[model samples]
Target: MPKNKYSLIRYRVINRCLRERRYVTLQELREACEKALDISPLSDRTIEGDISAMRHDSGLGYFAPIKRDRINRVYYYEDPDYSIDTIPLNQDEIESLVFAAKLLEQFKEIEIFKTFTDSVQKLVDVLNIYRISGMDTVRNFIEFETVESNKGTERLPELINALKSRTVLKLRYKSFTSKKISSHIIHPYHLKEYRNRWFLIGYNEEFKAIRTYGLERIISIDTEESKKFIDIGFDTKKYYENVIGISVIDEEPQNIQIAFSEMQAQYVISQPLHHSQKRLNNIKDKIVFEYFLIPNYEFYAQVLSWGAEVEVLSPKSMRDSIKQYFDSILFKYNH
Candidate 1:
């Protein structure tokens, strides 16, 4: 085999060994590589050379952070995400990547993705180097509206790190109704984004409930390395599956019916209110839409946003709630 082929084979064997076993001795790696590749067992010197190349080879520079255990003479990758396969992209792959990167760049002004500014720029530079005129045409022609930056975006990286590592975080949070900032130790399970605002859903140690905190209202975050993270077995997808937005209430989904005017119904037909939205009735100028949701604050707020264009027809409780909300607004204006 050619030298390049041999090196590729060696890199593959080494990567496979590292991924399969947390730590592997030189002898163990040689045996595994021999078995997997059906090649002769590599000498100790050859294995050491392979490990060094994986850590420092310019073309395949993985920066693997492979560490050696002095006592047991074993090696393992310190960072699990580090991989040699992510070396470079081919021309077509790079084009597609640039397309996606530019699309995501539309939202780069948002704090959540702002941290990727340097990285995305670097990617753009790489793409630019390999880009053809067609790619540029595709990129320049498309555009997205840049929205205003939301608060607590600077802390996105820290919060994401906490969630990834399952590290307990001490948060200084100020709720919308609260006057003073309160401190709570939380085990962050998931980070969510809704309407440009970022939120952390986690189990609050003091409150003893899985609560959601807007990243904007978060005053500060301190990682509690000393505290062990607790997994409350919260299913984020399942949690928000029945709801429209982040505000989750401890209630079952109720069948919600809303009647909309012909003009508004056309818009709703094209852009659904929720995944659960379905047309229940349409007679003359009125269209009735049905949805199954938890009727959380977000749902009510959404209904309110439609104003006189929408009317809740069923679920007396929710209808009453909507009525009171409008009544209060009217009272404020009337007073």
Candidate 2:
């Protein structure tokens, strides 16, 4: 006859009953399963199969050491605390587990995953003790991009902790354009990743405005436990909706139209510059793209990167800006 459909569950139920009580008769075990585990009453043959399977089955391999009373026909574990949950794995199974642990360890460098470092290290220690075969070769087979830690990356742990605790932070910062250091107390809202760098979005207490500070510019950060956290209810999506990269300009979003030469248009079509990009009517040798966004520093830089292949078609102010930028660049090269 086939084993019970829920053979594993029956094993666990039988294991518990044998462990808890000094001795339990077959009928008593069935009653406990029905009441405590919400399981259907099992037959004598099914319970007997479960006990046999738990002892020898490679998947479980539980050394239950069950003893039976000859006079009363009751069963119990010789070692009361013994359970299938603590079963030891074979060498092959241990190596397989070690491989899985190594995979998780690879991602520990990422800022968001910093909290799991201790747990991941514990797992790695087990792997080292076992000295799993081909463990050294595992790192070589798979390669992960290791980004160098920038200036402010060392402060990630403290910043993340402050954000989690909802504490206000005091940051000593120095911008690239400025030599002097400035201090501001900010309520951190979000951590944004862009172009291989990290930025913190927060409510600046001194300026009374929402601002983004690049992690590279931060000189030092300390949390203020005494200050009550102030949440201005900033809408992240709407705030950055029309802006590109990390910059948020004060101007209203406008329709931005640009014409790209036919040669360069294909690349733009494949990978759109902005999420709000829409293709417009193409001229004889140029493909036009219309984007709805606020003109920010990053957006301006992106337009400049394309150089002569692209031209601003609408928004005269932006067109003038781009023209003047090119004129200056040309004058510098000529000199």
Candidate 3:
């Protein structure tokens, strides 16, 4: 027999023997392989070469515990302590793990959710130690619902790619109310999703100002000669600090506050308008939930959603706008 083939035969024998036996005295390995695998194994030199090959090969080197034990002159597995066995995982548990991995990916965008995701991982691993997910649960599983449709299908993939590449995009956009098409040269800095709609924040080259554009309203996106956006950085938290809506704070700002009736307080508390929201004492007739913010179209839109349920308590500009909006909305239905 060829020397190489004889050494290959010796390699497989010692590999398995080492995991259980701790050490093989060259002769013992060849004898054991002959007994267990029913192969006419080779002599001592061949077994020695096999052990050397096992230590070197990346995959098979997992059996190096034998050499380490031999260095300390120790050999024993039969205080009956153990043996190497396949980790038992049925199909359902595998699927549950894949589901968990997908869930972690879903929350990858939200910076505030880091600690919560980490805690859930630790809790799941601990549960897995004792109870198998496939065997026990009867597959009473959680599923995330998709949006009705990909209204922004093509733009969605492009937006993600641009964010990854940090490239600039020229967008053909139409406003929700006004379908007039216009072009915007934007360097997309961040993507924000709120209430199932996607928003892009970027520095608009044409306007020479930072702007927020909705992905759904974007008619088309063209990759321009890519230029890096270095000067302008979007701090999502700071951007939303003083505003309840999508509109950025204007140069001249006011402390805009709103008061809600008892019926509306439940809804206001349920969805906080801003991070800086503070609750003041409730008036006899109304619940005053105070937020000092810039009054923008986005803010006005939110206020209008309340209809007669809320009242603007401060900043006369906001109050007047609310009155005008109410008049406009009422005219549509009342007239």
Candidate 4:
């Protein structure tokens, strides 16, 4: 690697000029670096030093096959296909790859990732081709948060195929509140994951409205080949833009303000609850945050998770709802 970031940038700029430009001169290389770096008056000697380092520097590991045409007085790579980017990965880079491959290994059994199983194994074998000791020991040092058995993952491949083919699906689903399993024909639109759980968002043909269903609650899924697929032109980004979690309510987005205790504020600031979260002026000793979102069960659950450390500050309806929850808890304790 280059000692500083600027040297690396200059190397890349020169590399591009050599690869793309015909008969690249020393002046042209200097101009390219100056333009890329947004600095003027880059000396010819500086560009020459950069080229020499790229060609000979063992530390950089480039050893680029750069050659100068004596007759035309131009620089070019001896190997037409040569690029610094194609350089072999260093030990650290190899280790990171090993880490990623190990993580993907955990999901190999899932139908959606079945195709990637052989590819991932081949990558692992390639990484170990040089007999790099301890290449397979990456999992010993790092542990990932993984579900031993994630329910409904088996349906992923079918759901993905349906989405691609724009096929309607008949689903038998059981809600947590009811023991009865209801059947519905849905035009699958989007799949979303929140807190490690998967949700299917689609247009329910029976209800004649867009709905969200927990994939875990889906007892069975069947392709409705006879029925016509509904194309609602669902914009995924716009649909979830004002929502915190999977439950996108019918109500308009509200400016919900919350105050957190100093202890909890640090955690909240480090990891924001929502993309629209913004820090406001502190209220007394508490740190305040504002969000433009349509509050749903997930949002409430998030706020309630903080327990005594959090307080809703605005929108009396939301405050009242949160208060009712706390009051019910207090009532249970009092009883």
Top candidate, metric lDDT: 4
lDDT (CA) per prediction: 0.83, 0.81, 0.66, 0.88
* Deviation from truth (RMSD, Å), model 4: 6.0
125-201: candidate 1 lDDT, tens digit per residue: 77887766554534677766665677787788788888788999999989999999999999999988888788899
Of the two candidates 1 and 2, the one with more favorable lDDT, higher being better, is 1
Query: Residue pairs in steric clash, candidate 3?
Result: none
| Tens digits of per-residue lDDT for model 3, 78-106 | 32333323234445555566567546645
Q: What is the lDDT of residue 74 in candidate 4?
A: 88
Q: After superposition, how far is residue 224 of candidate 1 from its true place, in Å?
A: 2.8
lDDT of 4 by residue, 1-335 (tens): 43699999999998899889745999899989999999999999999899899999999989999999889888999988999989989877777887898889887876667789999999988876654665455756788877454687778878888889999999999999998999989999999888767889999998898998888899999988899998888999999898777888789988999999999999978998889999998889998999999998889998999999999999999999999999999999999
Please provide TM-scores, in order, for all candidate models, with all chains considered together.
0.66, 0.62, 0.56, 0.74
User: Comparing candidate 1 with candidate 2, which one achieves the higher TM-score?
Assistant: 1
Among the numbered candidates, top TM-score falls to 4
For residue 22, give model 2's deviation from the true position in Å.
22
lDDT of 2 by residue, 1-335 (tens): 33455676677788887777769998887776666557676577767767777766666667578777879899888787787767766666666676676676665676666688788778767656666565563434665555555666656677788879888999999988888999999999888878768899999988889989999899888878889999999888988888889989678999999999998899989998889999998888999999999999999998999988999998999999998998998999999
The candidate, 1 or 3, that scores higher on lDDT is 1
* Sort order, lDDT high to low: 4, 1, 2, 3
